[model samples]
Target chain A: MIYQTVIGLEVHLQLSTKTKAFCGCIIDFGRAPNTCVCPICLGFPGTLPVYNKEALNSAIKVALAFNCQIQEHTKFDRKNYFYPDLPKNYQISQYDLPLSRNGYLYIYRDNKPKRIGITRIHLEEDAGKLIHEDGQSLVDFNRAGIPLIEIVSEPDLFSPQEAFDYLTNLKSIIEYLDVSDCDMEKGSLRCDANISLRKAGSLELGVKTELKNMNSFKGVKDALSFEVGRQAELLDRGGDMVQETRLWDAEKGVTVSMRTKEGAKDYRYFPDPDLTRFHINQDMIERLRLKLPELPQEKLQRFMKEYSLSEYDAKILVSSKEDARFSEECIRIYPGKDKKLMVNWLIGPLLSEANSRKVKISELNITNDELISLIGFVERGEISGLSAKGVLSQMIDSGKSARELIIESNLLQVSDTEELSKIIESVILENTKSVDDFRSGKTNALMFLVGQVMKKSSGKANPKIVGQLLSRRLTDA
Target chain B: MAIDNETIRHVAHLARIDLQAKELERLHVQLHEILGFIDKISNLNIEDVLPASHILPISNVLREDIPHTSLTPERALENAPSKKGNFFSVPKIIE
Candidate 1:
């Protein structure tokens, strides 16, 4: 029997505000243990916590970008728990009424737009870090009270691939909004998944399990894939799933049950007395809406229509904000409107160069002017496209201009008729067999003669011009 | 729903507090009375009244985005029950 999988994600994105959510401590990562702490974040007595306006504004910007409905009146609540990392023994979070709700994130699957409903986007403070040493644990409160936005998506994703696509799309929008870096490695953006399996076309949902410890998008997809198979096998054996929280042991590649059904905790949530309700007005929402940049979807559509590119090419260009910016900048400076060429370079060679260098495409040292100039050399017949690739490698290494590299390395294409004729004469004199074969009605021999000429010219001769001159000379001979 | 002994025990466990059987019995009774008062409010016929998250009419209580000097390591760890080289030491958690 076939089964269908359902997946939902909750991503916690640390806002890039200058200071902590409540206190005025500067937000710095990888600081010396807990030196950024203050009385307010340390949860000392007689210290009243105040909300940060920048955090709220950032949260509203993200909510509007996702098309969420902002709640006019929302308040913070205390999520009570007993963790060594939490000095206050409770987290300041939104329980019943969150800041926003009822939104959607659109992801393209199989060339069609799929909408995944966003349940809510709530603001909360981050917890501290716990480092375990030999026989003891260290608590660092520097990260405590940092502003975080929890984006919860509805259970609309039906496959692990769709879930991955949804996450990629979500991260793209977050990056474009300039709210957070969304770096998974630095722990700025973290994700947890809820997945279950049921019979195809079943009305009621199946027993779901919460998965944790997935650090990257690939890890999330792999964990979901593993869970889907596990649940399907249990159902085949006439067994049922138990409700619990499972930890994704990424190294071992399996989900281990961290707690069983009885492990569910009653948070006993109540309104935080310290923070007052937030009354979001229509004017505030409109102002934030205007601040929302052209998100990934809008930019993707515009790139396709304006550049006259295929959806596949446009999607690749707009997937990352940096790549999209590079493409647009190169096009703006290029003398000709060859968007396809720019798309090919940005998505093809430039991406490969970045990967080989183990850096982001935006971190590539080649400037837009250098790239445009390199492409211009090819368009102007100064260098063959093949020769330009060599020049590009040197340009990337030395951070020199394309023209500088071409002239320094003598990589100019041999398009001059008088100069190329000498190289062609020598190639014909040596390759007598191929010349005879070409006269005997073998067209493939003519290409061999052209290759010989290019080799003699040290690959500087333009192959197109070489082919034309070789055909004429062979016919005359 | 009425507050029960099982709920009280679970809540105490979540709060990380150890409670005796006699104490649990006393707390269950006290919670029932408190919840009873709250239940009475729930039974009132105020359908048109907007649910208020806070009693005060104040909203948008916020602070500006500015950085201030933080406490030094000495004062930051002053009240810690256990300390080791500028960090608060706690019992080792395996997970």
Candidate 2:
């Protein structure tokens, strides 16, 4: 059956704050079990939670970066659930009055920007970790009460690929905001997806399943893809799907039914009476807005316009904040009218060098002066392109100037006409048979003589100059 | 507003209050009477008033995001009925 997939993702981003959301417990990961716990986070009776100012600021920064409309008035709610991980049995989260709403994130579709609606972003406290053992489960409260902003997206994604793109772009922007590290392996960024498959062109929506346990963005995409296939197969066999919560078994590469999804009524959400509402003022929003860095989209658009880079090239260059800065720094120092040369090296040899080193391009030890001088050698025909490549590797490795590497490696191209004339004279004397072959209409013999000059110079001789000089000397004499 | 017996049972279950049958019957009558008395406040004319989350006009009660020392694991787990090493042990929950 031809079906259209609808997906909405919920990302829980842990703010890189020093302390917990409602307490001053240090929020360090990989610590001793329950070492970071306190009365406020452990839910001791009569304990009151004080909101973290930095957490609120980080949450607002994320909302502003995504262009979400900040709520004038926002309050926390008690989301009641029966889970051992939740020490309080009720998670303090935002319900009706979230931090912000009605934002959108841009995902690339068919080489054009597609705006995926961001339903809302709310601030909440994370639950604890549960590790199961024989006949018992142990709970660690260290992770509890960490400030987490839940970014919920509208069901604008139509395919698994779009969902992947949405997450990738979302993570990029969040990193640029410097709110969270967006590290999935550290459990700093977690994702849950709700997907439904409806008959193609159907207006009415199909029953959706909420998928969880996706530790990485790729895990979410793969789970969604597998779910789509599972649902489509079931529907084709005339079987209906029930709305449920499923867990992604990344090892098995399949999503298994965990439990029935609870309704909003089961949660019984209510405004948290302990923490009072805060009026998010225009002054605060404007302040955070000023602090927002030039986001991925803004940087990409500017790169295309100012640097004359294609969208593909601009997107690649601006994907990482550091790489974009490195490219821009190189271009700014480049002594040329058209910066395409700088862009080419950035997206070409430099990128390959970075890839081979298993690091970002900016992470390479490439200074602007050295790199520009390296490229300048190739442009002025002073060094052969091959020699420049060798010099570039040395420059990146040694952190030395291009001139230093060139001189140290003896890679300076023999481009001087007078100097090359002497080599050509030697090549003509040594390879007289090839010279005779060339003058007698053996056109290929000219290349043989050029190779002799290159060999005599130990590969420092520029092929273009040697070719030109050898052919000119042979034909003119 | 008339409160139903089922709702009373649901609320008791949600609150984890395991009440006896006689206690449930008696409380159902008392709770309805209480709700009926409180529902009279709805008749007051307050159409011009804005909804308030808190009554004391208090807001923005917060603290700086500075890490402060808290109870050690030994102190934090002092009251736990069951402890496995430093963590609180409970019945194994697979899900």
Candidate 3:
């Protein structure tokens, strides 16, 4: 139908503090369900919810990391709804004045950064979990009263891939800030995407459906793709669309209408009487802003400039905080001048090992010392490049040192000039034409002779040593 | 300052209060009188005055992020009408 898709995302991040937001109850997930409840969190009468200070710090850090404007005067509101998930009949969330607003996060689209606008970030208390059993539902109050921050984005994305990239970059920023657990499988990080389609050139927006329950980033992307097609077909048939909430069924790969959205008035949002308004001071904002580390974009640029890595390699390294930390450590501690050697090992052999093991590079448990020493084996020509690859594979599997594995497997390179010269002399007799070419100043022929020696030595001859010896033999004779 | 039956019924529904027809009729008049008394202030022009929900002029009350011992599960579920395995059982409200 040639309609441009308008997408905005709202991400709910659980603050990684030790306790619940309003109370001092331990927020230990999966600790026998209701064990974490207390009078404040359970909504017992005469109880007041106290704001968690650490949560404020984390939220301010995240907002600052994304370049948000921290509001000086903000307040919480009561969103009234009758649901079992919320132990209290109403949830304490923000209404008009939130903690921060007007932030922008940069996402790479078409090899250039597209600045996605962040509408606002507000702190709220999470609800409990309701498990629907045979007929009735069971509620666990453990998760209730946990601190959560709602990050609302502007409708800046146009496609499903753009939404996915936005989410990926957002998660990376969250990890760099180290605020939340940032795990989707565990529900620590959750996202709700609102997407609408309008005529290609029309300025007005179409009725957008709010999508929820996407378990992963890929699930969100897939659900959006499905929604795009579904909406386009309905529009093509000139059918009317309604604003509603839909749940993404990952198993069925379709979005089912959950409920027609009730207008905001239905919630009857009012200023929360129990919790008073917060006057966010400039000092707190400046402190949190100072606490923000080098975010993904700046770190990506620095990785390229400082380490001489390509834009592609730098992005891969800085995609996750773990990857960036590991690569940065290895680069910092690397004995050689060329940091690409360390980066190549990180993005190449170690990356393949991580993929096979189904983990991130940081989780592979190979310390930077171990990785650098393994790379050093290749740099010193103690192990041939081909055999070094084998040693690296076993190093991760067996958790052994590169020297130990090389010695045990007898895979050391023939770097000894005396031993390599014999193979070099035999190769010279075999390739007399290339030898004459080298004598005639065809220096490229030297590389061919090194390859011949390496082939004779069963790929064990270090090419560097063979070249040195071959040059000495041809010229000194 | 007028109160209608539909407005009274919606408000009652939102508050989860069961109101009889006779009570509804009585409240329709009673609520009108209540609003009429409060609406008398509308005649006074107070544009410069800032609206305040709470009389106190304080904000930013917060607590440290340290955890304390939580209540035992038995005490937590003690007031529940129905319980199942440390959970409060209720009618299903799934969408």
Candidate 4:
């Protein structure tokens, strides 16, 4: 029987706040083991927690961006647990009343926007780090008490790719808003996935397995794929599925059982007495809603409709804020009838070079005007497209103009009809057999002659002019 | 409601506790009392009202892409229970 895989993701994003969630301690990562700790963060006796207003405001902004309905009154709850990483022995999170609910993020898959329902987006304090040594354990409080907002998605995803697309869209929106860095490698953005397999026509959900410890988005995809296969295999053999929480082993590329699933009462969740119930007023919500910039989806549509870019090109450009801004800056500097040329260069050579050097477009020495000038040189046929690549590298390295680099490197295209005619005549004389084949209706031979002319000119010849000249010469013979 | 001995034991095992037999009897009564109070929440008409997940109405908090200083090896290993040179030491498992 064909089975469908149901997937949902819980993404925990560390808010880009300057201080701890409920304390004034500076929220700095990579600090000394206990340096960032204070009475409030360390959970020392006789210390009372005072909530940071900035953290609350930041969480509000994220909730509004996701189009969640803001609650008039909300409070925090203490989740009881006995983990060494949790210094307080209980994490302050939302239980019955979260700040935001009923939100949806629209992700484009296969050229259509798929609305993925967001179950909830709640604010909580992050736990500490546990370093496991030889037969012993140690703790670091640097990340403790940091503010985290966990966004839970409804079980609307159908496949592993949809889950991946949902995550990519979520990351882009969050990064564009300057909320969290959303760097999965750095653990600022963590994800947990719940997957189940049921018959294709079934409406009820099957027993789901929760996957954790996925440090990257690829890990999430691989773990979900593995679980889907594992669950299907079990159902094929007529075996019962166990609902459990599993940890993703990235190296082995499999999900291992961690523990049986627990319900809400297992955590002993209760309203946190140390914190007060806060209210979000209409003015505050309106102000934040107005402050929200054009999100990634809107920007992507504009790139497609207004700029006339391909879906693939627009998606790549709008994936990251830096790349999107860089492309927009290039467009603004070099407005023309053919905008696709600028889009191609921005997505192709520029992105390839940036990836190779492991640097962002902003980090490159090439400015918008330099890129515009480089593309302009190619558009005007002053330099061939192949020669413009060399010019771009030179511009990035030496910070020179495309025009200056063309002159300094002697890369002017052989658009001089007189000079190109000499190279074409030499090619025709040497490759007499190819010329004969061209006359005999071997159309590919004509392209070979054009290539020979381009090779003779060191890729500095205009391909269109060479083709036209070669065809004209072949016909005359 | 009557508290059952088997239900209390299952709850303790689910919570990963090694509760003694005597403690199970006491927990049976306490859990019954707690569930009775929680039953009050089910009585409210929360079907139409949306479930609240977060307390604040915020979205899209982000940080600048600036490379802050990273923890040095010394600071990273300062809290390690065992260390060998610059690396954290772990128990050997392979032969």
Candidate 5:
């Protein structure tokens, strides 16, 4: 029997607020243990949380961007648990009412767009880190109290690749909106996946397993792929699936069972009394909607239609906002009026150099104007393409102009017809056997003679003109 | 309403609480009363009403990509109960 895997992702994004969610403590990462903590975040006996306005605004922006229905009146709930990392026995989160709901993100697969529904996006506080030493564990409160927005998606994803694409699109949108860094390595963005397998046509969901501790997008893919196979094997062997939470060991490439799944009643959720409810009017929504910059999808379309770039090229350029901006600047400078040469150079040699140096194109010493000048020089036949590469290298290293490098190296194009004609005539005379072959049916001999003329001129002669003159002289002879 | 002994033990184990048998018996009646009172919510007409998660209509909060200086090794270890050089010290688990 065929089995279909159902997967849902819960992504926790740390908001880029200036302070902690409900406290005035500075929201910073990589700080000393307990250095960023305060009474409010540490959950002191007398400390009361005062919600940060910026955190609320940031959460609203995410809700609106995902097209979720906003809740008019919402409140925070306390989730009770006894974890050492959580200094406060109970975590303040949303229970019955979340900030947004019923949103969708479109994923492109096999040349078709599939809409994945978003269940909810809720706001919460982050917990601290625990570093286990030889005999004991050490707690760091630096990350505690940081505002986090948890976006939960419906179990609409069937394959690992679709989940990967959905995550990529989500990260691109969030980063483009300048909400969170969405850096998985830095823990600014984290994801937990719930997966289950059911009969291909079954309407009921199978016993689900929750996967945690994936550090990267690749980790998520690998973990999900492993779980899918594991579940399918269990069902094939007539083993009953158990509902449990599993931790992904990335190094070992397997999922280990942590504990059995807990029901909703386990948390004992209740409304937090310290905070007050706030409102979001249509005017405020319009203001934020207007402030949104051109998103990746719009930029991709513009790159294809206006710049006449291939789908593959446009996708690569628009994947990162920095790369897209760099490409746009290059096009603005060079204009690509001649054979899309600028685009080729930007994608090829420039990308290679940037990669080799471990830097972005924006960080390169060569300015957009300089690159344009180099392209213009090649287009006008002022310098050969080979010589232009040398000029570009010099421009990157020494910040020199193409014209200056061309003049210094005496590498001007030998476009003078008289000079090139002399070289072409001499090559034709020198290679008589080839010339005779050209007069006959061997067209390749004519190209050999043109190559000889270019070699004699030290690769400075324009190949187009050399070919034309060589064929003209060969036919006349 | 009186709570049963079996129900009290199940709820205690689900909550990871180590409760004595006598204590469970006594708490059963108290829990039953509390749940009986809370059940009044089911009487309200909320079939079509949506549940609320947050009060404010907030979205799209972002931060700029900038790297600030990290905590020094000394400061990072300041809160550790045991320390070895720059790292926190722990018992040896594997031989």
Candidate 6:
């Protein structure tokens, strides 16, 4: 009895506007509790609510990027609920009509794009934070009234890894838009999944459970995997499915039922009286669409075609907007060089350095000009690839360019054919046994002789010339 | 379209308002009268008309994206029922 897994995600992204959604209060993530609040955000009497135009603009940019159709008339609604974190009894959100809908984000699977349907993207106000310590809970109102957009996806994902891929692509698109930071650790982006399991090839769907509180993208994948297995086992054992919301206990690594349908909250939604409707115009959408940057997928295809980069290298370079821009900058700065070399250094050594330092590649102290100059040294045969790595490490640490670092450290590669030949002759004479082995057709002995030449030259001699001169000297002998 | 006693009690419970039995009975009648008055509009054939959420003719009421000075922690927490330091304290939530 094989089963199929169906998944959909509702992601909440906090827009990085300077002010709160409906008020003029400052929006800061880690500020002191209750500090970033004003009368309007605090839900005080006589404080009329006004929408933030910047938030609406960011939402439109994201919606357009996801290929959603912006509704001509969108309005805010009040979702009534009782929670300690919500300063107001109701959260101003969208109901019946959202800002945008029917968008699709294409994720690459098996080198082809798979379009995932976006149900809607709506604007809402975030609740405050609740910190429970000892016996009581304390609420921080700083996050309250922050503008958030709920992106609901249709049940198009068939596997947990597909969901992970969808989220990665989605995050990349959002980062490219520059609307939100989308940092999961700081709670700027959060995801919850609705997953159900059905018999393989069956048209009917199983009763699904809504999974909440998955902290990371990997957590989402793992939680959905566990839920699929659990539901499949339950059906195999002839157990009835229960419609409920489950919490992902990350520590226990299991889905625990948070609430059943009996206690389920019915958020009685109604049009919020304080805020008016937003009539999106064609002029505004066209202006933003013109301003939209080249997306990751488009950039990826262009990188492969224009730069002649391998699909693997192009994909890695375009994974982050910063890295993609950095690669382009390097290519632009150092024209007439092998783009493959730049791609290799960026994907290999530069990326590893950034990873070790726990910073973004663009945030590395070295500039693109510095990196291109470093590659230029290698291109001109002034430094070996090995020596260039040493120079790059120092450059990252001390903010120095490649040329300065090479001079200061005297890492210039010794490519002089005369000097290398003299060292190679001495090595052939000193290692007569290896010379005898090379003459006896033990071809690997030539490498040992070349290693001796490099060691005698203090690793400054170019290995390529060293190998060539050593082979020439041995055969001549 | 008419309101019933059971429905009134359920709505009251959902709203977290505890109602006495006599109060529920009285409100049930009053709620039905209000519904009965409003139900007259249902008889009109207004299928082509759009449902209006707001009566105002204006739309797109929005403000600029700028931050003004926020209230101090003291002022923000001033009206809370209970406050501890800079936070609003509440009963421990188990779930």
Q: Write the per-residue lDDT of candidate 4 for residues A329-429, one digit (tens) a residue.
A: 88777768788878888888888888888987767888898788788788787887777887888889898887888899998887888999999999999
lDDT (Cα, tens digit) per residue for candidate 1, span A166-255: 999999999999989898988999999999998998977899999999999999999999999999999899997998889898899999
Candidate 2, residues A1-477, lDDT tens digits: the string is 799999999999999999999999998897999999999999988999999999999999999888899999999999997888999999999999999999998888788879999999999999999899999999999999999999999999999999999999999999888889898878999999999999999987899999999988889889999999999999999997998889999999999998654544578998888998999899989998888899988998899998888999998899988898888999999998879988988899999999999898999988777788889988887788887887788888888888887788877888888998998998889888998999999999988888889999999888998898888888999
lDDT of 3 by residue, B2-87 (tens): 87899899888887899998999899889999999999889989899887645578788899999988999999999999999889
Interface RMSD score of candidate 1: 0.9
Interface RMSD of each: 0.9, 0.8, 1.2, 8.9, 7.6, 0.9
What TM-score does model 4 score on chain A? 0.91
Error of 6 at A393 (Å): 2.5
lDDT of 5 by residue, A404-427 (tens): 888998888888899999998788
Superposed Cα deviation of residue A345, candidate 5 (Å) = 4.2
lDDT of every model, 2 decimals: 0.89, 0.91, 0.89, 0.82, 0.81, 0.90
Q: Per-residue lDDT tens digits of candidate 5, residues B7-78?
A: 787667756788986788679778988989878878889999776444544433333332234345565566
Computed on C-alphas against the true complex, the DockQ of each candidate is 0.79, 0.81, 0.74, 0.09, 0.16, 0.84
Q: How accurate is candidate 1 locally (lDDT)?
A: 0.89
Q: Which TM-score does chain B of candidate 6 obtain?
A: 0.87
Which 10 consecutive positions of candidate 3 chain A have the poorest summed lDDT? A258-267
Q: Where does model 2 exceed 4 Å of error?
A: A260-265, A376-383, A390-408, A414-437, A440-445, A448-458, B1-9, B16-34, B42-49
lDDT per residue as tens, model 3, A310-372: 999999899999889988988999888877878888899889889998999998867899888
Better of 1 and 5 by TM-score: 1
Candidate 1 off by > 4 Å: A260-263, B1-8, B21-51
Q: Which candidate has the top score in DockQ?
A: 6
